[model samples]
Target: MPTSLCGTWDMISNVNFEGYMRALGISACLRKIALKLKLRKVIEQQGDQYLVKTLSTFKNYTISFKIDQEFGEFTKGLDNRHIKSTVTWQGSKLTCEQTGEKKSRGWAHWVEDDKLHLELYCEGEVCKQVFKRNE
Candidate 1:
């Protein structure tokens, strides 16, 4: 099994998030606000269920699901889109596949060197972000 990805993480770097937002058709105004906010992630697991929260001063998004099971999700504060999502382990990465209006939209996460790595993708644009454990 891969290292557990459970804890609070503070983002240290983010790249190409604007391009990914553009693919999601986010308003330029919202994108600008999102860009300036420092993001954090809180991951937790219990039994077969998992919860992941993307937090920031501007907005926050949360999702909960189990591996290999499909669930309904509303993007809520982010894009306000409804979609079906499934999460599964792919090698060392925990990947979520979001099926909705956008093509190839999803996110992947893994931990290495005590830092958490995330890749958020929509259409063809990918945003890479790295976070260190909050503690």
Candidate 2:
């Protein structure tokens, strides 16, 4: 059976998000706000379909897609850019590719020991985040 990612997660730690935002060409004001904002992730998984919502005080982003299916995505609050996104499972890790103007843009998600781990990358900067499962 495929791994299920249906739960709420609270941010525990974030590393290098400011640098990553800079690499993405986000404004300095936005980067400062984003660095301090708390993030919550709510994910719903049904079969091969997934809905992931990322909530923060500064911005909220939601994405819905099926496994291995490519879809057009617009990053509304984050960057206001369009990209073609595809998500696939690599073992227990969920890998996503965002193809657009940016180079090396993608994210990887995995759950280990009740903690949800995320690696968000763009350009040459990488942001690592850890979230604890909410009870």
Candidate 3:
């Protein structure tokens, strides 16, 4: 069985997020707002399918995908780009690879100890976000 990543996680620390946003060509105005906002990531998983939502006061982003399946991903409200994306399990980590204008774009999610960890990468910049499970 796959390791469970099916719980609500509250963001505790975000490192290098600005660098990641800059690499994605996010406008300065939007980045300012995003940097200050608190975020909650809610994940629901059933077998191979998953629904993940990133909620914030400024904007919310959601995506649904199944393991090993390629899907068209439209990142609306967040980078406003369309990309072909796929998610697969690499050991205990869930990894997503996005193909589009950006090179080497992807994110990996895993659980460490009692914390949920995310590494969001675009181009060469990587943003690390640590979250604690929400009760």
**lDDT: the better of candidates 2 and 3:** 3
Q: Pick the candidate with the highest TM-score.
A: 1
| TM-scores of all candidate predictions against the true structure | 0.98, 0.96, 0.97
Q: Model 3: per-residue lDDT, tens digit, 1-135?
A: 557888999999999999999999999999999999879999998877899999998899999999999999999997999999999999989999999999999999999888889999999999999999999
Model 3 residue 57 CA deviation (Å) reads: 0.8
Where model 3 places Cα greater than 4 Å from the true spot, the runs are: none
Q: How many residue pairs clash in each candidate?
A: 0, 0, 0
lDDT of 2 by residue, 1-135 (tens): 445667999999999999889888899988888889889999998767899999987778999999999999999878889999999999999999999999999999998888899999999999999999889
- Between candidates 1 and 2, name the one with more favorable lDDT: 1
Off by over 4 Å in 2: none
Q: Rank all candidate structures by their TM-score, best first, as comma-separated numbers.
A: 1, 3, 2
lDDT of each: 0.95, 0.91, 0.93
lDDT of 1 by residue, 53-134 (tens): 9999878888999999999999988899999999999999999999999999999999999999999999999999999999
CA lDDT, candidate 1, residue 133: 98
Better of 1 and 2 by TM-score: 1
Candidate 1 displacement at residue 35 in angstroms: 0.3
Candidate 2 lDDT for residue 109: 92
